[model samples]
Structures are given as C-alpha cells and as structure tokens.
Target: MPPSTVNRQWLLERRPVGAVAAEDFRFNEADIPVPTDGEVLVRSLYFGYDASQRIWLTDDGGYMEPIRIGEPMRTMGIGQVVASRDPGYQVGDLVEGFLSWQDYVLARGDGPMPLRVLPPADHPLSWHLGVFGVGGLTAYFGITDGLQVKPGDTVVVSAATGATGSLAVQIAKALGAKRVIGTAGGEEKCRWVVEKTGCDVAIDYKTDNLDARLRELCPDGVDAYFDNVGGDMLDTMLLHMNPLGRVLICGAMSSGYCDVKMQGPSNYMRICTYQLTVRGILLFFYRDRLAEGAAQLGEWVREGRLHVEEHVVEGFEHAPALLPTMFTGKQPGKLILKVADPD
Candidate 1:
C-alpha cells in the first residue's frame, strides 16, 4: 500500500468555453477509493496527454461519455495494480488503459478499451502509452488498414512531428512507400520531421504554399494521405490526391478540439470526382487487434525501422498546464507526464 492515506486528484472545476486553461481544473485531496466486485485499484505512474481529452470536456464527449464536473479528469495512463477484485488483474501487475488524473484509480477490465495487463518487455513501460500504446497502435492500423499504404506509393502525413504522425511517416517508409511527405508548422519542425522520421520531404504548412509544395513533391499526386490536422489542410489535400487514392481522417488538431462541431472540407466534392477512399480511425474499433498491432510496431522498433520520441513532464501538479500545450506548440512526439514510479 502507498504511504499516504489520501488520494491526490485533479478534478474538473468547469468546462472551458474556448481554449482550455489550467484554471479549469481544481486540485483536491480525498480518501483513497476501494475497489468492489470486478474492479481493480490502480496506483498511477504515467499520464498521456491527448487532444481528445479536450473533446471529453465537451457536453457530448464525442464518442465516449462526457466527463462530469467535480469528477477527476479522464486520461490514458499507466499504473500498477495495488488491489484487485477482478480475476483478470492481480496485485503487482502493471496495466495500461483509461485512468483518471489522480494518485489512485478504480478501473474495470470490460470497457471498450480494456485494462491491458502489460507483459514483460525490454522497452520502457511508458512506451506502452506512446509508440506501443494508442499513438503507435493507431498509426500502425491507420496506415496498414485504413489508408492501405502500398509499396511505391507517395504518402503525405499532416502534423508529422506529432506522436502519431511521426510514427506514421516512418511506418509508411517501412512498408516501402516510394516517397513520404510530412507537414509541420515551422521550418524547425519540418526539418525535424525529415531528419527524425525519414520523411522524403517536409512542408512548412505555416509558411509554405501547401498547394505548390504538394504539386512539386508529389508530381504524380499523393497516393495516400494521413490527415491529422483537418479543416483547410484536408480540403487542400483532397484536391491533390490521385484518383482512387486512400485518405485516413485520423484527427483534427486545427479545430483545437474546443468544440466537436467543426466545418467540413470545402473540396469534399473531389472525393467523388477522384474516387478517393476516405476513412476515419477509432482505436476502439481495433481493440481486439491491439496486441497484433503492437507486435508489428515492436518488431519495427527492434529492426530500427521506427523511431520513438517523447516529451515527458514530471509531477502531477503540471498535468493541467501541459494539456493546453497539446493544441499550442509542443515538442515532437508523444507528450507525457510522469507522476510516480512503480514499486
């Protein structure tokens, strides 16, 4: 058992109107919760920062249930099982799943994304939340299944310096893509995308003329597009796609996730004219194949075909502050907060 009897928590004070701020969450202490039937008590170690957390704060909560006021902020986290009423989880087992912003969390294994019992591995435990977790698994399935990237195909990935995009760039290369193009906000991030993720060309979307760069880089037209920053970027990419090309609508970071009601792309008519295959990816749909995706990602990592980058902040107090940076400029790769070390 932990030395402290109180559970340290960051609870939602109220939903934000536009941009999320640190003031929106209130830090409090309460008695540690006890697990009942089929539930496990978890001691959190790491918390992953995702843009979707902002969507959860909305009235509709996008796909999942909305997080209520006064409740602990929801997050994807790694924790140690301290106590268990469920047969699937045992005390001392490490798990990765939906954990809240608290020192201790009561988790069940039957959710859409189950509380996975992490196996012993040579990689860092936090990697399960990044490359081997949602970000990596999503990129793997999104490229392999959603976009159906093939050898000799020209691929473009928006938000290339991000957690999922960074991996998606390299995964496209690993699968023998003829050329991989990445788009970032600035020259530094664009350069980093090419240097770190092996992107054939990096477009500075903030400064560069996206249409001209796409025309020059992908003369034959983009065969596959991994859309992370939707809105105008999606609209522009649609006009450059080859006929029968594949597009994956993975995220819309440009909207800031402040509201779920976003404007659709103006050039969506191109989808019909080009006969493009546009699809959206939700990790919940591939829950059963998570391990299979992880295995492939692990193999790529070991073979030096994939690169893992993380921007990790320490301490529970910094959680709220780090969240706002997800929409703003954050460093390349997965954004994580280290709360505690497992026993």
Candidate 2:
C-alpha cells in the first residue's frame, strides 16, 4: 500500500475538442476511497493505454459510460486488492480490470468487464496488461475468429508496429498463412515489423505506393486483411482483396479518435462485388472466451512463435502526456504507465 493517505488523481478537466492533451486533465489529491458492499478497493500498479480511451471521453462513451468531468480518468489497469467487500475478491489478491488514473480506485465485479483475479504466472505482472491483456487477446480473436485466417492464405495487417497489429501479424503466421504482410509508416518500422513479428513482407505506407506494392507482392490478392487503420487504407485494401476474402475492422487510427464520427471506406462496394466477408472486433463480445485466447497465445509464446513488446513509462505524472502519442508517433508495441508496485 502507498504510504500517502491522499489519493493522487488526474481528473478530466474538460472534453477535448480534437487531439487529447495533458491540459485536458487536472491533477488533484483527495482522500482515498473506501469500498462499500460488493465493491473492491484496488491500489493501481500499472495503467494500459489504448486508443479507445479517447472515445470514452466522448459523450456517448462508445460502448461504456462517458468519463465525466471531475471524475478520475478511466483506464484498464492492474492493481492489488487492498480491501474488498465482495465475496469473490480478497485482500492481497492481484487483479486486472477497469481502474482509474489514481493511486486507489473503487472497483466492482459487475461492470461490463468484470474484475479478473490474476493467477500466479512466470511472466511479469505487467504482461497481464499487455500480451495477456486486451491487445494480445484482441489480436488472437481478430485473426483467428473475426478474419478466419487459414493456411495458404495471404494475410495483411495495417499499423503493423502497434500493439494489436504487431501481434496480429504473428498470429496470422502461426495459423499457417502462406504470406504475411504488414504496413508501417516508414522503412525502419517496416523492417522492424518483418524482423520482429515474422511478417514475410512489410510495406512502408509513407514511402511506398501501397496499391502497387500490394499488386506486385500479393499477385493472388490478399486473402485476409486485419485492418487497424480505417479511411483510405481500408478503401485501398478493399480493392485488393480476393473473392471470398475476409476483413476484420479492429480500429480506425486514421481518424485520430478525436470524435466518434469516422469516415467510412469509399470502396465498400467491393465487399459485394468480390463477395468479401468483413467483420468488426470488440473484445467485449468475446469476454467469455478471453481465457481461451490467452491460453493459445501463451502456448505460441512458449513455442517461440509470438513476440511480446511493451513501451513502459514510469511515474503517474506522465499519464496524460503519453495518451496523445497513440495518435502521433510512438514506439512499437503496448504502451503502459507504471504508477506503483503491489505489496
């Protein structure tokens, strides 16, 4: 437990108009909250950053409640149970779930994503917020179930350097994809994607002519496209997909996630003309199967088939500053902020 009695929090000061900035949050200290019946008091250890957090700031909150002003910033965090009023959780137990940008947070087991009791593992606890967390799990299901990528298929993943995209590339290969292609912004990132994630070819979206490259590299047309970027990239990929090809809409990083509104693919007509199967992935839908996904991911990791990457920033003060980097350029892999250590 933290020695300080006051809770350190970063509250949403105002709704962001465009890109989120650190000024949007105000730092304040308040008395540590106590858990009531059916509630668990968690001391946050690490906070995982996701693009969806920006959507949560919107009025609609996407699929969950909006982060109102004066409330602690919401995040998917790993924490230790310092106190519990719920029968399922006990003090000293470690958990992962929806927490907030504070030293202590009150959590309940009945939220859309319940508090998960983390079992002992040989991996680092932070791995639970990364490879075993949302990004890795999303990548697992998105490739295996959403796109149904199979052997001898040509698979392509955009934002190849991102947390989910990085893993999606490898998972597709593990599924026996004949050709695994990835898209990154530059030559360095493109090279890194191919080297680190086992991508057969990496397209430098910034320098290379994407359509031509896809035509030249994937002469048979892309069989499966794991789209992390929407907008123009989605439109381009739509035109290159083989008949009966599959597409998984995982994210729209192109929009910057500033507002809820996003541009739809202009070449969506190809979905009909080519008889393509397009699907969207929201981890909430596969909440029950998360363990199954994680288990497979673990096996692949142990077998040296999957690579895990993380960009960890220390100190809670850096939380607000790190969020905007998701839209801007950031290093490859999962982005995490270390707040405190568990007792």
**Candidate lDDT (C-alpha), each:** 0.94, 0.92
TM-scores, all candidates, are: 0.99, 0.98
Candidate 2 Cα outliers beyond 4 Å, as residue runs: none
TM value for model 2: 0.98
lDDT of 1 by residue, 1-343 (tens): 3336989999999999899999999999999999999999999999999999999999999988999999999999999999999999999999999999999999999989999999999988899999998999999999999998899999999999999999999999999999999999898999899899999999998999999988887889999999999999999999999999999999999999988899999999999999999999999999999999999999999998888999888899898999899988999999999999999
What's model 1's overall lDDT? 0.94
lDDT of 2 by residue, 1-343 (tens): 4547989999999999889999999999999888999999999999999999999999888878899999999999999999999999999999998999999999999867898999898888999988899999999999999999899999999999999999999999999999999999987898899899999999998889899999999988999999999988999999899999999999999888877888798898999999999999999898899889889999998998988999999998998999999988999999999988888
Relative to the unseen true structure, what is the Cα RMSD of model 1?
A: 1.0
Candidates in order: C-alpha RMSD to true structure: 1.0, 1.0
Cα lDDT of candidate 2 equals: 0.92
